[model samples]
Target: MRKHLSRVLLVLTIGMCCSISCKKDTLNINYGAITEDLSAYLYAYTSGMISKASPIQIRFAQSVVEEAKIGSVATNVIRFSPSINGEAVWEDTQTLRFNPSDYLKSKTTYIGTLNLAENFFQYP
Candidate 1:
């Protein structure tokens, strides 16, 4: 799990998502002062993943807006294109995690786009 988590993040920084990887892989940010512990925690917790069944997490300095739209496929207002079907479970009040129902598929290449942008990061 640690190895897969490490390979999930393309960019690591406190603020700003930097760049979202555009790919044909599975799906997967953040706010606050974002301490070192936070970054380390996210990597261990997996900020994102591909062809994997890890939960993607995002930490906010403040609470996230439209928490209802975040991880729900039907009511998601966060708008991740080709929408990800998962449970919107919270690790903490400020941390929102998205755990895909079944992200690992042998031959199926899952394509996801967030607001028209695609991610290209992956791991074996």
Candidate 2:
């Protein structure tokens, strides 16, 4: 009878130890936050066809100084492969908007590039 009690106590102790050591927890994921250690495109953005009359926007990781020369500098920043006629403006300190004069031509793919090597593109 004592041996059976000892065996039962041993099993109960082992079960208690296992339960205490192992814990069930939940993980949270942030969509806006960067997750990859090293990525080709670090910042997540949507590509391909954009809707009509919808302004194209560029978002920077950090805020920039929008100085007096920003108007001229913004124009030269974004360039399209097929060439697009648009007015570039600053939506905010970190966001730049390219508003096309009219709706973009259908079935046409526009390749845009951001030339951020200028002096006005400095981060503070």
Candidate 3:
């Protein structure tokens, strides 16, 4: 009787696993698009001190706008620019890169902003 019970449980578990894994993959295809009026926000890395010469790369949880739009908006808020103009590079679909014209000051805490609002940094 014990052996029969174990066999029944095994069969039930196998059936459950098969059913769960049989679902389709809908990522980036037929997952259905969602539209909203959300705006882009800033995200900063604060694990350690950022290098003075390192180019600031901005990433987003979701696609907000084109690379040019991020650069244009960032330029108006980011006040750490050595020059008025810096190169904005988009490396991936959700990442925007900016090479500062000057090195960041050492031991000085810098805050990032989005549309003149603060509290945009997060750790994940």
Go through the candidates in order and give each one's C-alpha lDDT.
0.38, 0.47, 0.36
Off by over 4 Å in 1: 1-51, 64-77, 104-124
Ranked by TM-score, the better of candidates 2 and 3 is 2
Report the candidate with higher lDDT, 1 versus 2: 2
What's the true lDDT of residue 107 in model 2? 49
- Among these predicted structures, which one has the highest lDDT? 2
> What value of lDDT does candidate 3 attain over all alpha carbons?
0.36
Ranking under TM-score, best-scoring first? Answer: 2, 3, 1
Candidate 2 structure quality by residue, lDDT tens digits, 5-116: 3332232222211101122432232223323321212232324344655676655544655554344436576666567788878766666678778877654445555554
Off by over 4 Å in 3: 1-47, 67-77, 80-89, 116-124
Model 2 residue 1 CA deviation in Å? 75
**Candidate 1 lDDT, tens digit per residue, 11-64?**
222222222334553322332233454454333323332335555555544443
Clashing pairs in 3: none
Where is the poorest 10-residue window by lDDT in model 1?
115-124
> lDDT at 98 for candidate 3?
64
